[model samples]
Target: MEPDKLPLVQCSLALLAERLTPRDRVSIVGYAGNAGLVLEPTYDKEKVVAALARLEADGSTAGGQGIELAYRFAERNRMEGGINRIFLATDGDFNVGVTDIRALIGMVERERDTGITLTTLGFGSGNYNDAMMEQIADHANGNHAYIDNPREAQKVLEEELSSTLFTSPRT
Candidate 1:
């Protein structure tokens, strides 16, 4: 991963924080070799942004583990009638744990059935698995966005935050 992409992600998340309300809970889970919770569920946007800024992409990407951990946090802090979504920001190159596409899709489908949708934020360009990212979002009743620059980030994380994060029930 290019070192600069991390800053873009950080800035994007900061922009997202500005849109969140006190009732919303935010948790960050990042994975390389293994997934770890960077921030616990909190309404404190500052803490969320700080955690994002501290993130330094390294090691092999355990994309599946990262999604699983994120779901756990989201489920734990889930609101009864509000949105419970996972924004998976990745290059979509799952070289490490749970690398199989079908298995990953199955996992996402199960989560979606339980009302936890996934939105894939594709970061970087080369070697980025656009197909996988789009498929994951499609199967999970979510959306996919490629964020390669600050303007695109603003468009996705700020301009379209409501529609991106809050979707109507699919009948």
Candidate 2:
């Protein structure tokens, strides 16, 4: 991943945080080789921002593990009738742990049925797995988007916040 995209991701996150409702619970997970919680699920926007602020770009991406940890955190603090989703923003594919595409998709499909969704935001250009991102989102009952600028980020994270975060009920 290019070193510069971190700032873009952070900028996009700032927009996302600004648009979140006070009742919205958010968890920030940054994964590379090893997955760990950057912030636990919380309703405080400032706390989310602070957690985001602490993120620095490094290591190979262990995206599957990252999503797993994200889901665990979201599941733990899930609200009865509110959005419980994981928004994964990345510049590339899962190159380290649990890197198999089929396995990852299967895992996401199973997790989606558990009631939490996964949205994927692909950033930068080369080495980015657009297909995997979209497929993962589809199976995870969420959305996938490629953001090239602040306007696009605003479109996904702010203008269309509800669609991006809210999972629809089955008929």
Best by TM-score: 1
Q: Write the per-residue lDDT of candidate 2 for residues 53-152, one digit (tens) a residue.
A: 7887665898989988888888888888766778899977778889888999888877877788888999887778999999898888888889878888
How badly does each model clash, as a count of residue pairs? Answer: 0, 0
User: Model 2, residue 9: displacement in angstroms?
Assistant: 0.8
Candidate 2 contains a number of clashing pairs equal to 0
lDDT of 1 by residue, 1-171 (tens): 464366777887788887778888889998968999988888787888888888877747999999899888888888999888889988548888898899998888888877888889987767789899888888788888899888899888877876667655454
Model 2 off-target regions past 4 Å? Answer: 1-4, 164-171
lDDT of 1: 0.83
Pairs of residues at least 3 apart in sequence or in different chains that clash in candidate 2? none
Please state the error at residue 119 of candidate 1 in Å: 0.6
Provide the lDDT at 27 for model 1: 91
Cα displacement (Å) at residue 34, model 1: 0.6
Which candidate wins on lDDT? 1
lDDT score at residue 10, model 2, on the 0-100 scale = 83
How much RMSD separates candidate 2 from the native structure? Answer: 2.0
